[model samples]
Target: MVKRCSWGTCNSDTRYPERIINVSFLPFPKPKTNYDACLRWIKACGRPVEQLNVNKITRDTYVCSKHFVGGFPSEKNPDPFPATGGQIYEARVKSRKRKYVELEHNSAEPSCSVPEVPCIDHVNPIILSRNENDKDTQTDEIVYTNLDLVAHNLSIKNLEEEKNALIKQNEDLKMQLASCVEQDFKLKSKRSPAKKHKQVVNNKKFSAETVANSNIKKLFEYYTGLTYVRFILLVNFLFPEEGINPVNYKEKRKEVKAMLLTDQLFLVLCRLRNGLHIKDLAYRFNIKPQSVSVIFKSVIHYMYLKLGYLSYWPHRDTIIQNMPQQYKQEFPTCLAIIDCTELKTEKPSSLKSQSQCYSDYKSSTTLKSLVVTDPRGSVIFVSDLFSGSISDNEICKESGFYKLLQQLKDQGYLQDNDGIMADKGFRIEKDLGELNLRLNIPPFASTATQMSSGDVALTRKIAAHRIHIERSINQIKNFKIVNRRIPGTLFYNINEIWTVCSLLTNFQDTLVKM
Candidate 1:
């Protein structure tokens, strides 16, 4: 038989046709001697055997055949020798060194099971190298590599941008706050300011001498047929005790009547009524043109209130009974002869007033008045004041004349057999037809027909009848107070003066004819 293998040899396999023994399982024949030899071998490898510290044999200390094939037996293993412990263990010295080196390179801790590293994509490798050198040197040497310098510059730029953004936002907020504060201040200032209290004064004083000397008293007596005292009594009866006293009563009545006789005032009104210039009236009255204007306005106000009633059209029956016999037979239901006339006024100072007062017909500043007359040249009605800017049709509608006609119709006073005569400006034919009233309008006369014999005969008759209206307007305007340009303050007074003049004309006509 072949000599059996003694120590540290493996013998057992039919494939090799020989018995093999494993050295790891071999028992130590001389323990101290073998252990010393193993220790010496370990020391010769330049690794310390004392660090292995293998003293006993155990399963945990055993190394398998796989470990031996990998050639890991070294001092780095827990047990390098198998004869002492009857086991072998593998060393991972090179692997551990490699892992430690990798961890340092990546700046990460290593684990035996797995290794983790911070994502290197976002980190600049150049910057990482600098950091490693700095760690070794323990000195903060600012290695400004292209990537490291770019990163630092970018960081600085970002910081500056953030600071600028914050500053801009701060300024915007301040501006908004300032605006709000200013608005609040304005609101506070809008409130009303404080004012001192005032005491009421009550004093009654009259001048007998001045009253006696003023021609107003004489004029008042002539118009009202009463002294100041009697006139006050009549006024008291009409108005009852309101706030008016003897002093106010005397003053107002004297002022009202005296306005009609004022030389300058009367002259201007006479000029308006007769269509005369201010210079003409000024010469006639021996007063300046400016004085004429002042007087005219005063008189207009005085007369307007006193005579405004003349503007009201009488009832149909009243008009009929008062009509002349010829007019009654031909146009028994004739209510009024309507016409438009322009009154001259001063040039307006404002553009709007100039435009308003300018009349196309007169090519001057004028106020248009609508005059209505009966057959006897007596004015029965006049319209309220209107701008010369308006058309005749517009004035008629705005004057409430249509409503007045409707009212007459509803009252059963507008007779179907009756009619109204008007110039071409009225366009009243269709309107009167709707009310079952007739309209008599004259036809336009051409130059050829105006000179014809038959035309002239018919024209004469028509003119004779139509002339009454013109005469009536002339009579109404004859009042010196209505003949001239009225003052702006006395615009309403013009209406009153027109009415009073109309009433006077009616009175005169009645006294003379009837």
Candidate 2:
């Protein structure tokens, strides 16, 4: 096979040992010039040649030793040069060569445009500008002036004072320049997004084929935490009608860089399911971190809108019919179980927001929500999230849970005697005293340290039945976004994320039997 040097400016045959170096051994520094970078890039990737075994070669296939003095740079001498001591390898020569060529071309012009003067040949001819003088007379006059100055008395102190004044002026100029530089830096920082955008455009990207062409079970679910079938179910449920705007602008738009809808959806899910950071998604999706944010925001909004299918309060009859025999037998009047959970959130910069979101219990900022589910573990209600600072009673009332309960009661879905089981967190004795409702909670003591056997038995029974909602919450958090700290960018929609995830729990093959 005929071989040619891949390095720019090296086109010699590679058959000669003196001309070629083994690329596998030497690690060359990154090319500085565009021409060299292009060649280096293609050469590293290899070209469409060896496959056919025709012995033909691509332009970027080899680097001849001619491009390096001692051959290609390696551990021994990383800064090797060309074989010739004078012409160093990779050193810029175009400007110098151009200058020499221009000088030769301009040689035809008179070396000195001015006519010669008497005894002018003894002086330099190049500086004879406009006048016939060789400019030596000006130097002679300076020498005569210095000699006359020496003949007179010149004060050294005056020279030193003048020098000091000039130095002070220079120092002031430098201070002003430094201040300007500092201000410029602040301005640039304030406008860093554009600079970051340029960096994002260069990140490596891949086609949808990366996921589309792979099996769902092998690694897809590992990364996304959802099986392909379930993911496809979500896509089909919301797509075509509720999907985001298509990335494609025109027919068969080749060279398009925007992610495909499936890929985009998958990328968004991974962020939520795995709690992946924007940068992590950027590298996986082969896009910029900012683009990841853009895709995530657009996709998550649509998914939140599509949450209707995932969770809903089942009608009273539906709940009764699906109610497992164990729940019905144990707690016949038990209507629903309610619990509160806190999801950690990224700290907001606003003092008010941070104070409002800070959770003393969790020692962090969080979003607190109340989840009410039927005995069968199907989520009936996931309240609008309460800021962590809000008390449980306030959340129960402000989230419209009381209103929802009123509707159920008025609609006869919940009877006046049907009870709502809760954890100790609820203090309905004070909040809903006038409603005459049955609120079953674990026994607490302000007086004695011990509980009566009857009270203990009641607590255990109620807990056994209420455990389903706890299970429901656990299942909901399986969708990671809520389980992990909610990213700050999505703090505004923490409620939506919670609702959607909770709703998705209902789709899981009846994890709640009743």
Candidate 3:
């Protein structure tokens, strides 16, 4: 039997060593051991899976070294395949070398074009030619310029300048005339008895003025995710100086066509709460799309800082005081419920980023964040967003939540017997032990065919309390920006936006009843 290269269109065979020199045949990987690598190799062979069988691979099945980088596969490139058929390593290198050799061989000789006779009517022009070698003799010719042609060219340039000047002057006069007409019209309108033209309001335009004029609380809530009174409070908190008179406030920097800072804030909130497109927001705000984007980023950054207090971890006494009746009766020591939530996002163009952001559970690209809520369903702490591929146990450990709990324990805010509630997905009992705190996760049926009766009851009770964290997560996702698939345009500030949404959920109505 002949050992032939299995690569696409490759003719390398052991029987014809003279036809293809310095090439060796490699056997296919065994499916039982390196199954994934073997599949990849078979796919790289460019043969249909139905036509090939890895189980029947014999010594005659192989791939040639010409398909690999560096003319061979090494430890660094054990699973080798050509990126493209035309980009085969050996072939590309040989083609490059052959072209270089042809250039070098051709350059060894010097060649020049024969000179042509100049027409009698026109001035002669100089010709330049250079050769690589020093063997060619060169000649120089005298050239003369046409005076009349040069003068005519200069006159035409002067005429163009004069024409440009006249155009500018005409535009200036037109502007002056229009200004005079506007002044005359204003004077006449003031003197005339004609009823003043009613100022037309654009209902489509969204701003503080529009919301105030509409006086619709639902519209306010729909746009900002906050009622009228709460929205006012939020504005005051974010911009204390301009809180009372944000509509009339003037910015030090020139505003976007005299737009108020409050309007910008309203625009940002509408974008976050409604997931409004940048162009739509621009149209509503009477500004350019770029301006809307800039305002949204700048204001959201400010809001991210202003809203940072919402993520504060409540003191132990505060947590106990706010603990719901259900938690107090069954699990008095329960402090906070924790859970990881994911939001779908656009698939990233990069393969590495796609892998990092993909969630097998969601089966889509997403961003994940850890949400921590007290028993009363108030979001106390929200961690920065992590890649969706991260595991719940890993997120809990790496998100600084455990470390912070340990710090609180050292400070006497968190005690040894106090418990952190979470689902069985969090395998952090050992981690909590290091912090001198207890994990209140429901019992897992690990190593058991079935859970005992007591384990079943405990699981139900824990799940009843754990449901608040889920509700809190739902509240955070109520903001449409984090609820739907986040666009790639917002990926740069996605962490900040996700944090803001999580924190803002603290301002919403409580999820857990007393």
Q: What lDDT would each prediction earn against the true structure? A: 0.53, 0.63, 0.74
What is the lDDT for 33 in model 2?
A: 36
Candidate 1: C-alpha lDDT: 0.53
Any runs in candidate 1 off by more than 4 Å, and if so which? 1-312, 445-459, 511-514
**Model number with the top TM-score:** 3
Better of 1 and 2 by lDDT: 2
Q: How are the candidates ranked when ordered by lDDT, highest leading?
A: 3, 2, 1
Off by over 4 Å in 2: 1-218, 240-258, 308-311, 410-412, 429-437, 445-449
Query: How well is each residue in 1-514 modelled by candidate 2, as lDDT tens digits?
Result: 6666543355466466564445322223334433444333333323332331123333334444444436555434334342223222232222321121111224543232223234524533222222245544443221112222221222233345557888998999999999999999999997798767755553323323455446554466655655667777766776765545543232222212455577777776676666778888777656667677666666666677667544366566676667789777777776788988888988988999999999999999988998898878888888878789888877898888887777776876766666778988888765454554678888875485678888888888888888888888888888877898777877666666677677766556566543
Candidate 1 or 3, higher lDDT?
Answer: 3
* Selected candidate, larger TM-score, 2 vs 3: 3
Clash totals, every prediction: 23, 9, 0
C-alpha lDDT of residue 54 in model 1: 34
Q: Clash pairs of candidate 2? A: 6-62, 19-65, 69-81, 69-82, 69-83, 310-503, 323-514, 324-514, 376-514
Better of 1 and 3 by TM-score: 3
TM-score each candidate: 0.42, 0.54, 0.59
Model 3: residues with Cα > 4 Å off, grouped in runs:
1-200, 203-205, 212-217, 243-253, 309-311, 446-449
Q: Candidate 3: deviation at residue 255, Å?
A: 3.2
**What C-alpha lDDT, on a 0 to 100 scale, does residue 186 get in candidate 3?**
96
RMSD of each: 32.5, 22.9, 28.0
